[model samples]
Target: MTQPSFGVIGLAVMGENLALNVESRGFPVAVYNRTAEKTKTFMAERAQGKNVTDTYTVEEFVKALAPPRKILVMVKAGKPVDAVISQLKPLLQEGDMIIDGGNSLYEDTQRRTEELEAVGLGFMGMGVSGGEEGALLGPSLMPGGTPEAYDKVESIVTKIAAQVDDGPCVTYIGPGGAGHYVKMVHNGIEYGDMQLIAEAYDLLKNALGLNHEQLSEVFAQWNQTEELNSFLIEISAEIFKKIDPETDRPLVDVILDSAGQKGTGRWTVVSSLELGIPIPTIYAAVNARVISSFKEERVAAKEQLAGPSGKYEGDVQSFIDKVRDALYCSKMCSYAQGMALMGKASEEFGFNLNLSEIARIWKGGCIIRAGFLDKIKAAFKENPKLPNLLLAPEFKQTILDRQEAWREVLAVSNQLGIPVPAFSASLDYFDSYRRDRLPQNLTQAQRDFFGAHTYERVDKPRGEFFHTEWMENS
Candidate 1:
C-alpha cells in the first residue's frame, strides 16, 4: 500500500476532526491514539471509506507516513507534547517533521524547536483555531518553523485551512514558536471581545431595560454594521436566542454566573507585562474572569454593598446606539493592543512578522475574526510600520467620531453601578494614547525621590536622565 501523506496522533475530537479534514482534502492520513479503543473506534466510524490508516504505536504511526515524514501532534500542551516528541524521536529520521497543533506557550515551542533541530529533525509549532467544528471543516492555521519544513507540508496546510475572499487562512508565521505566540495573542483578543460583548449585554439589559429577544435583535442588527460585524457578536446574538429546555428561560440566564479560562488569556497578559507592552483591555478581560470566579463573595456583597438605585431615564434607543458605539470603539482598542503586542514581539524576537498578512488571515476562521480586520490589513499594507491601529486613519476617524457616544455609554453604565471594565479600560487606553503627556512626570519624581531611579526632564532631550537628592536639598 502507498504510505499515508500525513500522520495525526491523539484521536480526541479536535484531532479526529482535523485528521478527517485532511483526509477530506484528498490527503491520505495515518491516525493514532494513546488509547487503542479510540483509534479502533475512529477508524471504524469516521475514518471508514476514507484514506486513513490506523496505527497503535508511535513507531507504527511514523512508519506509516511517507519519507520526509510529517506528523501532527494534537495532544494536550506542556508535558504530553514533550512526551510525544520523546517517544517519536528514536523512531523518526532526520528531515522528518513534527507539528505541534496544541495551545502551547511559545517559549516551550522555542525550546522544542531548538532541541529537535539539534537532532536533525524539523519542528513546527502550529496554532489551530476555530474550535471543534472548524477542525472538521477548516481552521485558521499559523505554522512557525524552518521554511523547508513548511514547504514540505504547505500543500496540506493550505488545503485544510479556512478560506476567506482573498485566500486560505494559513500562513508561515515565522521561525521558532511565532505561531503559538500569535495564537496566544489571538486568545487574549478573544477574551477582550467576549468581555466587551458581556458589558454591552449588561448595559442593555440593566440600564436600557431590554429583554433577551430585544437584545438579540439589537446584536443581530449590530452584526450587519461594518464596525461591529464579527463571529463573536454573531454567536452572542444566537446565544441570546437560546432557551433552556429545562427551565423555559433564556439559556444564559440559567447558566452559572462564574466563568472558566484555559490559561491562554492569562498567558497573553503575562507576556504583555514581560514585554513592557500595554494591553489593558486584554488584562481587564482576564481580571474580569478572575473576579467572576469569586461568585460567593459577589453574592454576599450584593446585599452588603450600596450602589446607585435609580432607574435609567435616558432615551432607550439612543442609549442602545451609544452602547453599540462603545462596543465598536472598544473593540478597535483591543485589536490595536493585540497588534501592538505582536509587532513588539516580532521585532524583539526577530520574527519579522507581516502584520498585514496576519490581519488578512485573521479575517476569517478565528475566534476574533471580524470585518474590521480588512481595514486593519489595509492600514498595515499602507504603512507597514504603523505604530498602532488606533492611529490608522480608518480606525482613528471612527474612534474620533464615536468618542462622545462611547464616553456617554461608559458614563451611564458607571452611574447605574454596572461593571464595564473592558469598555472602561479600552476607553482609558484610547485617552492615554491620544494624550500629549501623562502624569508620569510626577510618577518619575516620586520614584527618583524614593528609589533614586532618576527622571528625565521635559526641557531636556530624551534619554538624558537626572537625579534629585531630596534629602540632601532639605
Candidate 2:
C-alpha cells in the first residue's frame, strides 16, 4: 500500500527486469503493460513477494506513482514509443518525466525531448546496455537530458549500474540525443569487434586447420591476455565449446551462416559519412553483415568465382601469434574509428560529451566491455582534448609494435583467398592515419581538373584554394 516512487511501462523482458532491479535497490516500483495478462504473469512469477506494484491501466499506472513521477518506457523503438508517449501525455501532469530506455534513433529522441520540454514535462533518452540479465542485476546506463532531470533518478540508476574499481557504469552523457548516439556508436564498435573475432576464427579454422575445440582453447587463452580480454572473446570461447544436442556437433558449426542486423550499425556508418568522419572498420563490419545475409548469392558465387589455390604453409604457433596480434591491433583501430566519429558528432551536435567518462562507464556491463577501455579512459583523462585514440601515446606504441604482425596476417589471409574485410579496412585506416602525406594530392588534382572543385595549395596558407586550367584550353 506504500506509494511507488518510480514506474515502468511495458512488460517485456527488459522492462520487467529493470523494474525488478529498481525494486531490489529498495525503490518502490509500479509496473504496467498494455496487455494485462503480461502484468498479471510477471507479478505472479517474478514479482512475487517483492516490493513491487502492478497497475493494469494507464490511469492507475500514473496515479500509483508519487507526484513528479519518473517512468521508464521500454517499449519497442519507433511507432510503439510514440504511442506510449501519447498515452502517457494525456494522463500525466506537468513535471512528470518519461525515460526512453530503448535503442531509438537519436533524431527521434531529439524531437521527443523538444516536444515534451515545450509542454513543461521532462523527457530523457537513456541508453540501457547489458541486455536481459544485466537489466535484472545491473546495466551500463547512459542518460541524456537536462541536468535536473538526470539528478532526479541519479541515485536509483547509479545504485543499479554495474560497479567497477573506478566507479559505476553510469553517467550523464549530454543533452539532446547524446545518450542514444553514444549507444549507437557502442553498437558500431561491437559490430567491428564481432567481425574481427569472426575473421580470427576463420583464419584459425580454415587457414591453420584448427578444429572447434582448438578454436575454443585459443580464444580462451586470448581472453587471459591484457589486450584481447573482452566479453565477446569470452563468450566466443564458450560458443565454440557448445555442443548441438541434435547433431552432436559444435553448436556454432551447426548454426546457419547468415547473420542479422537491427540497423544501429548502419546508422553509425551513415552518420559518420554525413559528418565526413572515416570509420572504415565499422563500415566494413556492417558491409560484412550485409554480405553474410546474401548467403544464396555467396554460395552461387563460390562455385563460379575462382580463388587462390595455395594454402598457408608456415610455423603454426608463430602464425597463431601473428593472428592474435592482428586481432588486437585491428581492434584498436576499430575503436579509434568509432571514438573519432563520436568526437566529430559531439562537435556537430553540441553534445559536449566527456570522452573519459564515456570510456569509464563502458568498462563493465556493456557488450563491448573490455580491458583496453581502461587505457582509453586514462588517455582521455590525461588529455581531455585528445583528438583521436590512435594518437594516444599508449595506443600509438601498441599499434606501432604490432603493425608487423598485423600486416603479416593480412598478407597471409590475402594469399590464401580468405576475405578479411574488417582487418583490411582497419589496417588501411591505421596506415592512413599514421601517414603525414598521402596520394590524395593526385585525387584532389583530378577533382580539380574534372570538376573545378578548387584545391588547396601547399605553397599558400591552408585555407587558400586555387584552380588551374590543366589542359590550357586544348
| Candidate 2 Cα RMSD after full superposition onto the native fold (Å) | 1.2
TM-score of each prediction: 0.98, 0.98
Task: Kindly list the per-residue Cα lDDT of model 2 for residues 34-146, writing each as its tens digit.
Answer: 99999999999999999898899999999899988999999999999999999999988888899999999999999999999999889999998898888988889999988
lDDT of each: 0.92, 0.93
Which residue pairs come into collision in candidate 2?
none
| lDDT value, candidate 1, whole model | 0.92
The best candidate in terms of lDDT: 2
165 Cα displacement, candidate 2 (Å): 0.6
Residue runs of model 2 more than 4 Å from their true location after superposition: none
User: What is the clash count for each candidate, in the order shown?
Assistant: 0, 0
